[model samples]
Target: MSRKIERLINLTIALLATKRYLTKSEIFRSVEGYEGSAETKERMFERDKDDLRSLGIEIEVGSFDPLFNDEAGYRIKQEKYQLDLGAITSTEVSLLSLAAQAWQGASFDEAAQKALLKLNSMGVPSDSLSLPTAAHKIDDGGGDLPLITKAIAEQQLITFTYVDSQLDRHQRKVVPVGLSSRSGFWYLSGVDQDVQEIRTFRIDRIEGEITSTKGPKDFEPPQGFDPARVFDGSSSQSFAIIDVRKGKGTSLRALATSAQSLGEWDQLKLPIYNLNTLASLVLWHGIDVYVQEPLELRGLIVAQLETLVSNHG
Candidate 1:
């Protein structure tokens, strides 16, 4: 592109931004970095004006100009410029502010805060509200979310320090595959280089910067592979299920959605398992959960409950 053309585009954009019409002389004064004779500049402006018109700018020649007597200039109509705020209601703003505060301590995008602020600036009435400043408190100490996000987007392998629920820390080199959220917890699904197996690690448990290894993220998830099934503590060797009811049913539904083979539970005959996953499901679901199948599982639940009662006893 010619320098003249570039400058013309920039000047046109600037003139349109002021929400007012500008004469040729005014536009020339406002536009910088253009050095040419008056006749040459005039010729260039005329060509640029035609170019702008060709580009659908609607550059009016004889537009209203208070400074000149019946002078012509260019103006972008107000209707042409739009920043749709979605007709925000006061109640919606309050609700959005509350929702943003709730994400204060969690992993979130910076754009989220900016978008919230922009919404508030547009008559959202968010100035009186104080959201949790905990969001800003998070530094680049734990996880480099931007790097991880880029790696995930580029389908690149990432190496990072991952700590399990058991508090066991290890350096994990994994092929970054996918990201998901469950029960308000963020999870990163990837293939462990050490184990050659796909696994899901909680994002919060990751306590170090993730480095992109530039390794090919070309591995495919195994056929019939299911992430939710991995969390269920069910493997090719053994598997189990339990009837989860009430909110537990919702959990099971989420699991089923993520991993289709978990199937459904018989609410009347709730299935239970001796597996850690079934136990976790029970514990997570709390006292209202019941063991439906497998007498062994029932015994395991009873044993755990007895231990709990004895601990409190």
Candidate 2:
């Protein structure tokens, strides 16, 4: 790892290690030997804080007294912290198991196994620990499981071939960042080299070797790249607020009835990243949801509706 990233990780580990929050000055004093002067130490502190944020660490800093005006300190929220694996969901247990079973020879296997054991010790029902049908049936085609898992384990890059729903094939190289499960599918979030953008691809669609490649020494993800947004099917490419309504709260016809109906009700604002996905969902679950912002999404939804109607008619 680069010196900056290494120091940042050390700083995060140090912050997470302590119970009481520490002020920036305290942190700088603690890390005085990290090769910097007082001014450089302050800059390093800011950089380390930004790095932590980039890695999705929610560190809060604030002062208790306005009159006294003591230096602000930082602390991780204990409620969201996970020091044990056993408390995680059974589905998560199964996914971990699949990962373990698929790539046992990887460098992180022992650690992962220990984590799995910790989870198994937890109260997840025995039956629920079994891998789901989708996961169990996924053939690896005798591919290099160790290499793939190592890539994920070491936070490296991996390239693979995937077959889309249309039966078309494409080769994609991605810097694997995270993995997640939603709606009964496993998805890998990564930065696509070809597109030069972050994207989520269904693991089941993956058709070839998960080749391990050296990660870019300094590549970093852009801010606000939430992997879940891709599967949620509603995210904005840029910062843009849009409104939404739940199906249960209001009828679609009622919502569209009059200016009063639309104005008087509360709305759910969202940043749509994939408008096409949102359009498809609206078509699939008609009258159950409403898109209230970014008129473009509304237009896309209308177009999708017309396409569906024409095809069906």
Candidate 3:
């Protein structure tokens, strides 16, 4: 971890550990990371406060005496800082863990880990029960979600390198209107300014950091635009058949539109958005999942496995 992050975590832990607000002088002396001149420490504290607040962690700022309005103190309130989800079940824990995993290598990894630690303190023991649901998670574009979501909320245009299905890389400028997750993969629904079309970019396919386009971005989506329906209204629907081992691939079982029990295994029929996506989910299951149909989907998985073996060998 970097010094800034370590200092921020230390600062947060201190504030949260205290029941009452701590004054700046007390924090400088108590917090382990503060150093250098008093003025330097003061600047660091201000930036740290803003950084924590940017990540949705609220820092309570107030005075001990309302009438006197004395020197202000800072602290994080448990009620405001912690997740509001109460009485979470084991299944929920697994799902939450999977969500947390998406941030493992992302910029928000530390903050995500903080939330997971909070879960442990909540007396909810996480488990491997969401094996099937866990398959829905892909680590691709999730890391850049903090920036993308921020841009969407602020209605800004972003530029990034995108790797297409053909293994070609191209720079893309998109005014993200909204974002949607389907089949465990996230897709950014936006107005592609370069192509001048309503386009959807799979988050996993993005090649690098998504930076904002220069100048002011007051872009808007088409009137009455709906992101969730970006993949809707296709002329034909496609489906995939996966034979999953019994008591495994729970997420697949839940998403299956139809299923047939086969003694030791379950044959599942699921609507598929694309062969690549279906292959990605199937790969997550490893030997536990087998594509029963759609030669294309099965071929994709087989090819990926072949490449994996070749590279390691």
Candidate 4:
């Protein structure tokens, strides 16, 4: 791991040091880790480029020569790569230091350390900054995240079995555009091959291994593809009437359009976007919440709870 990190750092330095864009041939000849056969070097360089991009290093690719048509070259522009949020106040510096310190023991600790080192080099004092220990942790989405990210970066097609809100499983081929996290769940937004439309799938709902169907840079993401706009907000906003125990269902309360106190129970008229997601939320409160008006939603929750019980049993 240390050797890989060192190789990436060396590659970045070499790329940034070069004034002109360096081609694959030049990189293989000049970089430290490019040993063995031509095929081996090519594979190593490809993986290195992906790794560097994952680390937030922007590698620009273009032709070095205008007079002659040559293979495209790659270079990390020093200006684009450097963090230059010019002349921040002391309060902002202190806040940044705290933010950096919050990554301690997390997946981003090393990257945070390297960033702080760069900031310190720029005359910002971060070495002695103290901060409260992070009380929360972010899950890195297991093995699938890296593969999905690689596909996104390389503009490659991917295949995965995704379970929808209705619990129907379907095998899908997609060109992933972006990934986003909301309410602790990760979603992959992409162009679905069969439907020929933009679709978003919950990462956790992906049934099995995510497979790459094509090589890097095979296709380009559609121009101005906004993943957030893929879902139809109007279609998802269906109302549900439910009763919750007093002092419970705090999260659900935020979704309630109207709430009325009925002795020990609080009746809520809520707009449910995804029934499966809402069912999960309701189930989290155990027997404290009850769906009254919608028989279908109540049935869904009961079925889900039964499946959970059977699985646990």
Best-matching candidate per lDDT: 3
Candidate 2 lDDT (Cα, 0 to 1)? 0.64
lDDT of 1 by residue, 92-207 (tens): 77766666555454355355586578667776564355555544433222345666677766767888888865688999988766665556565777778899887788777887
- How far out, in Å, is residue 121 in model 1? 20
User: What does candidate 4's lDDT look like per residue over 222-290, in tens digits?
Assistant: 788766655434335578999999999998887787899999999998877777788888889988999
Clash pairs for candidate 4: none
For candidate 1, the clash count comes to 5
Q: What residue runs in model 1 are displaced by over 4 Å at the alpha carbon?
A: 1-143, 216-274, 283-288
Clash count list over all predictions: 5, 4, 3, 0
Report lDDT per candidate.
0.64, 0.64, 0.82, 0.81
Runs of candidate 3 exceeding 4 Å displacement: 1-14, 17-21, 25-57, 64-69, 98-118, 126-147, 160-172, 180-186, 192-198, 202-209, 213-226, 234-313
RMSD of 2: 16.3
Worst 10 residues of 3 by lDDT: 133-142
**Of 2 and 3, the candidate ranking higher by lDDT:** 3
- TM-score of every model? 0.43, 0.42, 0.49, 0.55
lDDT of 1: 0.64
Task: Work out candidate 1's RMSD over C-alphas.
Answer: 12.5
Ranking by TM-score: 4, 3, 1, 2
